[model samples]
Target: MSDYCGGCRYDPKQRVGDHACPYTAGYWSFLARNETEFSGNHRMRQPMQGLHRLTDLDALVDQEKARGSIAP
Candidate 1:
């Protein structure tokens, strides 16, 4: 919950329901920012492969949750 981008440190509420939603931006940015850290990690390699093609955050979260990577 930032004031600019949800993934960034700036999530502006006004940006919330738009195509450029902060959550979306933040989500991608989070991945980009941590790609290297995750790429070689045993737990993230498979899921990381789906990042670029994943547009549904909830679904992605659910998938990861099912894999036991995310906390319930």
Candidate 2:
């Protein structure tokens, strides 16, 4: 609802696809990359569970890897 986000090309609420925010996508990517390590963490339990529910996780991971080092 902020003025700054009104004309932004990226969507903070989205985790994948053309309009996905780099930060949002990166967050999920980071969680996915370290899923095994964070599996045993109680603090990560909810996030991990949410990560598993993303149907586009594989695609998101691929996209993030391809976007490496590029400024979004």
Most TM-score-accurate candidate:
2
Compose the digit string of candidate 2's lDDT tens values, residues 1-72: 556667889998888789999988999988988899999989999999999999999989889988983233
Report the Cα lDDT for residue 26, model 1: 55
Residues 1-72 of candidate 1: C-alpha lDDT, one tens digit per residue: 644443554434322233434454455545754788898898887767767566665554554445454466
Clashes of 2: 0
Best by lDDT: 2
Score candidate 1 by lDDT: 0.55
Model 2 residue 5 CA deviation (Å) reads: 3.5
Query: Candidate 1: deviation at residue 37, Å?
Result: 0.6
TM-score of each: 0.39, 0.81
Alpha-carbon lDDT, every model: 0.55, 0.87
